[model samples]
Target: MSTAQRTAPAGADRTKHRKPPARRRPHRDQRWPASVFLSPWLIGVVALTLVPMAVSLYLSFTDYDLFSAPRWVGLRNYTDMLTEDPRFWRSVGTTVLYVVVAVPLKLGLALGVAMLLRSLVRGRAFYRSAFYAPSLLGASMSIALVWRALFNDGGSVTAVLDAVGLPADGWIGDPDLAVYVVVLLTVWQFGAPMVIFLAGLQQIPSTLYEAAAIDGAGRWRQFVSITVPMLSPVVFFNLVLEIINSFQVFTPAFVISGGNGGPADSTLFYTLYLYERGFTASHMGYAAAMAWLLLLAVGALTLILFRTARSWVFYADEEGR
Candidate 1:
């Protein structure tokens, strides 16, 4: 055979041994579809939330009535609020008292009812619905109106108390008692948290209870050891949520007090006070400062909850924080 022909056959064999190139898949912009789907929420957060927040923060430092141009005031609004504003401090004190009193009472009632529901064997759904009904209308203006009427002078609550020979006068009028009336209103709407606690209860392992029973532990013992540790995470979650909700309470105070936060501003919650300053009195700059302070207060409380959660909140699958 000729040398050229031999070399050609060898080269052809080498070519046959080589692998073909891999094909590349075309890149699709998956993010665009997600962005399209998320556009509505993004627009709402920016337009209704972010823009307003930025504008308010800027206005907090300036004297901006609704009609006039914003005049720079530096830290005057904040300084005045901290020192010159008595109602500001009163509102703060009232809000703190409300949050402290209402949150624990609400959570306690909710947990107690949840435990009862967990034990009940019949008509559970009906009872759950009945209990949760109040939560549905809890924050509504209609419910606030109804509650006001129920507690008003010579109203149903007052009439009942009078018939029973107890002093039920001026629930919505007494400075000492008006705030408690609103607090009771909040506590009555415990169904939402009850439902949440019920869910958390169901998630706990029944086997643990069985084991505890076998170990001679009583129902109370099991609840203290097994139930509390297991349910701590849920309790913490509900605590944080209820705290936030309690701070933002408005409609009940507004409608109950006739939009004046009245009976001598006794029902003057922080948000109600903020609204009065901003719209009613046209102290827009001062109101803006109050709003920011509220934001900070809520943020601080939430942060504290998170920080302290490590001590109590537990997770089964992971190490405690």
Candidate 2:
């Protein structure tokens, strides 16, 4: 045999070594079960969420009063909403104001309570559960009713205000201050965010505080320099959540205002107004337009917050600021 022939595999061995092209059918077959498992969720999204949103979008451009056929009028709803509806503007303003006032108050109270709970040497569980109890009610009608009962004119809250020597002129009905009652109720339910803040605070390293103390930093300085930076990401999270919830505030306004946006429309949150337009007045198309507008506004605000977070929010795992 030639040296080359000997160095290479014999013909029979070469035939045995030659492999067939890899089969992909088994891998493709393996994906079928995952697709099958995901089908229900995909079906639900399509049937429940996407379908309703699509119908709402289409309805937003038409005049559908729940009885007559939808009359297509391109951009009329949008144009009228922007140019003609005074109530739309009022609702927009009130919702924006509520978000601005309620979100910060809720976050501040929650963070403060969280820090307090963190420092407690005992009864942490009891304090956490007690503080979080109100949030467990969520936006239930009962909670709203209770809030109205407590804060209405001559109610317990008003009585307390009077005890403090603060003048009260129709607490829940005051056009100028009706919204603030809702804001107060929101602040009272700070438990959810407080729990989240407590969890975040727990993750912070104690060594950082010890080091700051060693460097001659006082409690306030340590908190500002170390605690705030480490806890910033949690703050951003609570901020976005509270802003969205504040804009959608309705049950409290509805129950408190007797299904009318509070006296003079001061508590006409965007969602409440949308509900009235759609269901009470049967202006479903207009309501749909308003709904889309609210969605866009929230999305814009959330986007702005996310952009703003780039400068302030910190993460332990991040390699760069």
Candidate 3:
């Protein structure tokens, strides 16, 4: 064979033995299937939530009633709320009282109910549903109406008191008792926290209980030493949410008090007061200022709780931080 022919065949063999270059994978942005799936949620976030939040923030600085043009008032509204408004301070006091009293009571009842439900062997689902029904109905207009009727003078609650030979006054109308009724309403909606506690209870391992039992730990001891520590995270969660909800309470106070805050303005919650100012009294600018103040109050309280939680909350995972 000629040298040229031999060399040509060897080159062809080497070329054939070499592997082709690897094809590049598509870029992440080019993956249209995932983006198509997420498009609806993205649209909702931008259009419904983000836009409204931005608009509300902007409106909070202006004196805009529903019908009138928005006049920029700057910090005058804020100053009026803090310095010139007496009702603002009164409403703030009422809200602080409600939140401080209601949140702990609600969470305590929730934890107790959850522990009871966790221990029961039969018909657990039935009890859970029954307990949760009130929470589902909470904040409903119907429930508020029912509350008004129930606590009104000569209503069913009063009649029951009469049957038991106890004096019953206008619970919803009397200033002293009106706020208590609101607090009771908050406590009645303990079902959400109870459900969360139930989930937390189920997550605790049975071996811990068994070990406690082997050590002759009583039920109460096992609960305090084991259940509570394990459940601290859930407790913290319920506490934060309850505090936020209690501070934001409005419907019961509004409906039960006939939107006037009723009987010396005792049930004048912060939001209800803001509503009265903005919509009823036409103090839109001042009300907007109150709304921002409330937002700040809630945010500050939540931040404080989160900061304090490090001392109390126990996480099973080492990487919880």
Instruction: Tell me how many clashing residue pairs each candidate has.
Output: 0, 0, 0
Error of 3 at 216 (Å): 2.8
> What is the C-alpha lDDT profile of model 2 across 21-55, one tens digit per residue?
34334444657888899999999999999999999
| Angstrom error at residue 141, model 2 | 1.5
- What does the lDDT read for residue 223 in candidate 3? 85
Kindly report which residue stretches of model 3 are placed more than 4 angstroms away from their true locations once superposed. Answer: 1-26, 29-40, 66-68, 162-167, 319-321
- Model 2, stretches more than 4 Å misplaced? 1-29
lDDT of 3 at 221: 98
Best candidate (score: lDDT): 1
The digit string of per-residue lDDT tens for model 3 on 1-321 reads 588885455342245456332312233344697789999999999999888767766777888887788889777788877888788888988889998898889899999999999999998899999999999897898998888888889789878877888657858877888887788888999998999999999999999999999999998899899998999999998888888878888888898778888778888889999899888988776676777788888899899999999988988885566
The sequence of per-residue lDDT tens digits that candidate 1 reaches over residues 1-321 is 598885455432245456232311111344578789999999999999999999999999999879989999999999999999888888888889999999999999999999999999998788888999999998899888888988888789979978898768848877877888889899999999999999999999899999999999998999999989999999999999999989999999898878888888888899999999999889898899899999999999999999999988888879554
- Scanning candidate 2 in windows of ten residues, the lowest lDDT window is 19-28
RMSD of each: 10.9, 8.9, 10.6
Q: Rank the candidates by lDDT, best first.
A: 1, 2, 3
